[model samples]
Target chain A: MQTSTHANPRALRDIEMALERTKAEIPVLTPMVTAFGPLLAERFRLREAASGWVGPLPVVDAERFSQGVFVLADSGFQDMSAHLSEAAHGLLPIMANSFPAMAQELNTLIAAMDNGALTMDALAAAGFGEAFTVPGVNAETMDFAVAELVRPFVERQAQDLAKLVRDLPWRQTICPICGGTPNMSVLRRIRNDSEFIQAHGGRRFLRCSCCATEWTHKRISCPSCGCEEPDELVVLSDPSRPFERADACHRCKTFLLCLDTGELADIPDPDVAALTMLPLAHQARRQGFVPLAEHPWGGL
Target chain B: MPKAIFIDTTRCTACRGCQVACKEWKNFPAVPTKQRGTHQNPPDLTHYNFKLVRFSEHLEGDVVQWYFFPDQCRHCLEPPCKEASTVDGAIIRDDATGAVIYTEKSSKEDLETVRSACPYNIPRQDPVTKRLVKCDMCIDRVRANLLPMCVKSCAMGAMNFGNREDMLKLAGERLEAVKKEFPKASLLNQDDVSVIYLVADLPAKYHEFAVAGVSGSMTRKQMLARIFAPVRKIGQQVRG
Candidate 1:
């Protein structure tokens, strides 16, 4: 095992404290569990696009790079090809934007990979890349690229929040710390576990980047146009997950994806977790709705 | 009306959302790249990657300064690339978005000359097509009343686009606020280019050539040609 050579005294102290915390919390964060266990049992479902669909999700044809999923593993042109899948890649990119720093990291990783500067192993080790257990090269490639682009953006965004916010502001969508846009207009990622809540978890939401400030955008309020009009705000859902829906603001012709995690046993990765709702955005876009926020990994 | 992009480095988190979004929106295919140790992927601007978030980190005293420069074409007010390339319609200024567009006609000109003329060192040529390319400020999206994909996908408020007057106003307000925190904050090429950069530190700290340079004088013959070419062309037409 290699040790980090952080020479800066303050940074080293911070790292030591963080390591202690991680060691103490390991039992909670890494509870022994089988892959695809009780965590996914509550709402593990898949929804496919309908015939003749003309929405945000692309129709399957020569461009159906993967079966119901867009992969960019060996894609010569990863960005251009990744969005072919309506349900998978379509939603991932928008959700990835929820963390701008991660999005940037992912973009760099992708560029590095294309330039042969990054390898699959290096990416996974640094937590900037992932390999899907999917069958074909296309599926794996797409998943790798998506993960590569998203992870760094997420970590860096969180890091910036910790360092930048001296006194967290009240009402705004942009991240005051870094004037970056957030893809998801989070109402709140409420922790159902009382133990976690006691660990300083509170109701904090994400913001869009155009103006840098994070406000309490209401859970039900349309993220686009700040429209609270019930009639103008349309929620689209499928049977796969009733809790998550695409909230489209008719007034602004923009849409936001929202997840109600109050019902989950665990916190979800908003980027990949939002994949189940891809059909809704596809349906909405076909109806002439533009996405107020887009995903970095998933697009079509 | 030529289009432009105003980048405020203070707002950038080195997120490459604009880069990916630009590729996605433009339907440009991804080029194969390898990790070169830096976060900057693909190394340099190519035919595919138009907008790149450049990263540079330095230590100034106790503060470890890490700078993010989202680099692209400056689209100079009076473009030197256009002046260097005499091929008709090679590079044009779009009336709608004020975008400097490089058409197929650019293939007729010498790529080296056009590339050298750019003060910002923008304009990459496709080896196969022999045409120059750079940021077009998402002109198609502008025409449709949609913000450029890069601007829209920017989760960081680093990239801003709008009417020149409005962007300038916003830039001014931001500059004032940034100055309170960074006394050295200043706008780059505010008057000479469409793409204005509001840098929080010395521009060089952000990226090499983050601002236009007057580092060297042109050679006597080259300088004379540039200075007298316009007058001579006009005189020849008048005499003819």
Candidate 2:
């Protein structure tokens, strides 16, 4: 059984505000925002398609679980692939004029996905790797495009799976919902009710870049290397934006940007917050540490 | 496989690039000091300074010989300082980089006990933060697939960092070549620690604690404390 909570209107408002703010803030990202705006608008449609679909929950073996498996097989995405492919096609304008061949390839790929002939292996076999290498279209940009398309459906699936596994022990750094590494972390004051008093305490949760799943993680441990030593960990922040900081692991030389939602007057979408924190990623790189996951803006 | 750093002292020219680079990378402010009459400034390692290149001179066979020892944490394979830490997360060895890190929680630990347990006398306490500090092997740079600041800044190729096996191989090759001139050339505590030093003369000539077995200064109580530390930690966790 799944408990349904009403969607917060403020979160949608935050995403809209962020989309507008990002365009004005970073001039270099204008083209990306222009390309992604329409695709993001299609998320509700994809979510509708995902909600109407029915499938059994994935069964993962212990070995696969340890290896960070969330989606068990290619069949899991069969029901929602058409909607995802339609989303992928919506980004065709960004690709068509610059690289006709790549756009043509994407068209074929989308058609194949719609036809149930585009499993991951089939997509690989259909020269997706070669298509992504086209001029002005690299792996990172291609990843962003695909993620924008599939995220809505993947997120819905993840939510349903998350409901079933709420009580299971998952200690790994990877997201238990979608098996994706975290691109950002959230530091929020979680409400607690004990005795007769209500209180709040700071808790850290990692948000996945792929499916938007959030999982509780230890506050002190490095998500990358699992180094619990407090001295080896350092939190760096831009002097101007103290609310956004990078939790760096000196031991592993890796960092993950964290957003203190508690500090925000208006909470921003976590995905949009990731875009705003590109400067933090560059700062972490300047200090000789890699981001746990690559940001869409490529700073990570 | 664990990572390690190999320092060939024979190739070092006492340029102090490694020392300066460490301070630069860590953003450590310079310590104020009077002239100590030697090239080594600040006299000894402090909380701010994690790496220090020590200079020593001795007369051997009526000839003046100078030994330059770039002193830092050895990052022992089984760190005694970690064993001595009573406070949780005061000290921990990084599983990926093999760095023995002194965390901010060290402020809650007995500094003397943690300091005395180190066979190499590496940890230093900050007067302001009340936290113990030392070399963390430049793990940040290492994890980014770059050499440690000290190794990167070394122009003489005396400092090298890589996998344990590759460093041991380099140490062995350097030792073989150095042995042609100095028969006593050897790698110091290579098996016991991550930082392997290739010294052309006796290990003591480089630094007092360059080799592990040579030091018997650790008190019997410290030894016993280290031996039973793991058991005590488990018992405490269970009790809690």
If you assessed candidate 1 against the hidden native complex, which CAPRI class would it receive?
Answer: incorrect
Cα shift from native, residue A262, model 2 (Å): 42
**Each prediction's DockQ?**
0.01, 0.01
lDDT (CA) per prediction? 0.56, 0.70
Model 2 agreement with the true structure over B23-108: per-residue lDDT tens digits: 99999999998897888776889988888888889899999999999889999888888888877888999998788888888887
Local lDDT at B58 for model 2: 88
Which digits, one per residue and each the tens of the lDDT, describe model 1 over residues A1-300?
000111222333333333333234333422211111221221111111212112233222322321222111222111212222222233334433433434554444445555656444444433333343322224434454444333333333333333223233333343333334456543343222121112112343554332122445445566446678789988877654554677788898877666554323223344333433456667878888877656543364
Which portions of model 1 miss their true places by more than 4 Å? A1-300, B1-3, B214-240
TM-score of chain B of each: 0.88, 0.91
DockQ of predicted candidate 2: 0.01
> Which run of 10 residues does model 2 chain B get worst, by summed lDDT?
B213-222
lDDT of 1: 0.56
Weakest 10 consecutive residues of candidate 1 chain A by summed lDDT: A42-51
Off by more than 4 A, model 2: A1-300, B214-222, B228-240
lDDT of 1 by residue, B38-81 (tens): 89886878888888888887988998878888889877776777
